[model samples]
Target: MEPLGQDEIRASFVNCTRGEAKGVTLPAPPSEIPWDRREFLGWRDPKAPARAYLVLPYGGEVIGLALRAAAPPKSRLRSNICGFCTTTHGLADITLFSARRAGKAGREGNTLGTYACGNLACSQYVRGELKPDVPQPYESLTVEERAGRLEEKLHKFVARVLESR
Candidate 1:
């Protein structure tokens, strides 16, 4: 993935209004990110724990999506897997995130949810940069294949977010 500037990241959003894009927190500058090791840039908002974001170079352009995380349960933790990267993590490390569909569907309160890394670190997870204590579900896949699968899943999720009513 190529490094992206702040403006490029803000303009790449397809599922939210321009103002919403501007308001959400963005990842660090490209120079600060480990670009070569990342398949996509993702992060959770420091000011809003429930808010998360993901930006990726898809097709010929970058695509961004804003996600809202469900509040954590008050009871015991349970194991979960990220929908995009399919990486397994402890209960506390996984979150259920939802993205409002684009266009009129969003206005009608339509949303799509998936279990994801709580910190939005699927890139690092798939790259083995952040190892899971337990065996990953994709242990059989090569690192490259795991990254490719992550990208493929991300694209599908983004497409769903951009889909019209």
Candidate 2:
């Protein structure tokens, strides 16, 4: 995926209002990101750990989404797998993140949730920069294939969010 500018990132959000897009914090510049190894850029807000964000280059334009982390369970384990990168992680490292539906459904409080890396490091995990304690199902696949699969899942999730209304 190509690097994105702050303006482009802000304009790419389909699941949030314009004011919300302007107010959210963006990840570092493209030069700071390891683009060659990343399928998408994701990060948690420093000021608000509960708030997360994901941005990817989809179709001919960039697509961004705002995510909210769900409350943790009483017990922590290391067996959960991220839906995007398919990497297994400890309970604290995995989060159930939810995205509000786009447009009217979102304004009405509808959201979709999936288990993901708590730190939003799916790109790194898929690239093998961050190793999972448990073996991933895609271990047999080439790194490029794994990354492609991750991107496809992300696109589907985004589509679901936008079409849920």
Candidate 3:
């Protein structure tokens, strides 16, 4: 991923009004982000933990989404896997996040959700750079391959958000 500026990030949102996009609270300016270590930029709003955002270069353009994190599930499974990076973690570490669909569908209240890292750190989790809460299952794929899959999954998810409208 390439580095982004504040204006670019704010203007990339496809799922919300320009005013809403302008009101988004970025975790930090793009200059502080480790661009090489991220597949996309994501973070939860400190003032509103349930509110989150993801921005990425997709389909040859930068796009962004406004997401809301669903409450953690009370399932029997001891661990959960992130749909984007396939990284395993304690149930609390995996969260279901929903994004309002772009355009008229969003205006109509349509939304889509996917299980993802609660901290939105799938990029680091997939690379073994972030600590795991549970013993992760071994995989034969190299780090690059895993990273590639993460990108593919992320792109597909973003596509769903865009196409839902």
lDDT (10s digit) by residue, model 1, range 48-94: 88888888987788988888999875657567778988877888778
Model 1 alpha-carbon drift over 4 Å, by segment: 74-77
TM-score of 2: 0.91
Candidate 3: regions farther than 4 A off? none
Q: Output the lDDT of residue 57, model 1.
A: 86
The alpha-carbon lDDT assigned to residue 36 of candidate 2 equals 71
The Cα local distance difference test for each model comes to 0.84, 0.84, 0.91
lDDT of 1 at 74: 64
- By summed lDDT, the worst window of 10 consecutive residues in model 2 runs over 130-139
Considering summed lDDT, which 10 consecutive residues are worst modelled in model 3? 156-165
Q: For candidate 2, lDDT tens digit of each residue in 1-165?
A: 776778888898888889999998766766787777778889998888899999888777788899999888667465788899888887777899999998899999999999998898888887778876656663588888988899899988988987964
lDDT of 1: 0.84
Off by over 4 Å in 2: 76-78, 133-138
Q: Which of the two candidates, 2 or 3, achieves a greater lDDT against the reference? A: 3
lDDT of 3: 0.91
* lDDT tens readout by residue for model 3, 66-137: 999999898998888899999988998999999999988999999999999999998898788998879988
- Measured against the true structure, the TM-scores of the candidates, in listed sequence, are 0.91, 0.91, 0.96
